[model samples]
Target: MRAIILSGAGRYADPWHPYAETSARLAELVAAAGYDVEVRDDVDAALAALRDDVDLVVVNAGDPDGPVPDGVEADAQVEVDDTALAAAMDRGIGVLAMHASASSLRDYPAFDHAIGARWEPEVSWHPPFGEARVHLVGTHAVCEGLDDFTVEDERYANLRLLEVIEPIAEHEEGGVRHPLVWAREFGRSRLVYDALGHDARSYDSAGHRALLARALEWLSHVPAPTADDRRGAAGPTSAT
Candidate 1:
């Protein structure tokens, strides 16, 4: 299977995220999961490369609203066009959106719907970075058989969700639990949003790596819904 990783750069890059480091780690995991991986740091050109032959797209980008490096003007930064990327999804390519990617590709408003969530600047935030406890939730292929694990990473909370996602993993903050990892289908495309992978350290966790491997495997092989299954299915709702 061919997997394309869109590493953050230019307008999609921020000072806080080590996009290259985390993306390299992601490449290792994806390769281990049996994918021929390609990493591209130029967000715009990378999105344009999304074609029918590509099996998966891993989004390891930074928040577009975050602080840029010194001497870089935020407003003046380049905006990306996701035309090919969107069309590819419609053609049934899967997506795995990593941390901070929830806020990436904001130039396309449909991005929120694509990834199933959006990181609202003032509303969505994370606590201090450190070892965090991630609890496995329902029985889903992506997270099934995995135990709760702790890893050094930032715990994102209160992200604005745009769909009824089936959260397979979550983390607690201020006595409230927030979905940290979830799976959903976007039109014909399968999608998984992982709220981990802040840096290489986060990938060091065996549980985290296993989770990602399973996510890749699952994304690679999604069965199309049968006519009978569709007829018996409950319609979409505000929650899963």
Candidate 2:
């Protein structure tokens, strides 16, 4: 299988995150999952490159609408068309969104729905980065048979969910359990959003690696059902 990783750069780059380093780690993980991986720093270009042969698109990017810090020259505003990406998903491409990617690509209005979630600024925030225990919350092939595990990373708290998603993992903060991982289907596309991977350390966890590997394995073969195909079930399936 083939995978294209959209690594953050230019206007999508942020001061707080090490996008390049973490994207390199993600490339290694994706490659180990049996995919021929290519990493691209340009978000729009990568999306434009989406084709029938690309099985997966890993979004490891920063928010384009976010605040820009000092010393970083913002890239000129470039025209972005979501037509290619939307068409690709309509054709059953799998999406693996990581961390702050929940907030990336805001220029594409449907980007949040495509990933099944969004990071609402001010409303959504995280505490200091530290060791966190992630708990499995539901039954899904991506997380099946996996136990809760700890990792050194940022816990994305209170992200706004945009779709009916099955949350498969969570973490507690101040007695409130917040979802850290979820899986859902958008049209014919299968999507998984993981709110971990703040840095390379987060990817260093054996458990985290295992979870991501399972995600890749599932993404490589599964075709999520469209809305019409989900109507008569007991409840919405994870892929619906």
TM-score of each predicted structure versus truth = 0.89, 0.91
| Model 2, C-alpha of 161: deviation from truth (Å) | 1.9
Instruction: Single out the weakest 10-residue window by summed lDDT for candidate 1.
Output: 222-231
Candidate 1 ranges with C-alpha deviation above 4 Å: 71-79, 226-240
Candidate 1 residues 28-63, lDDT tens each?
988998889999987777776566788888989986
lDDT per residue as tens, model 2, 164-217: 888889999999999999887766778889999999999989989999988888
Positional deviation of 154 in candidate 1, in angstroms?
0.4
Model 1 scores what on Cα lDDT? 0.84
lDDT for each candidate structure: 0.84, 0.85
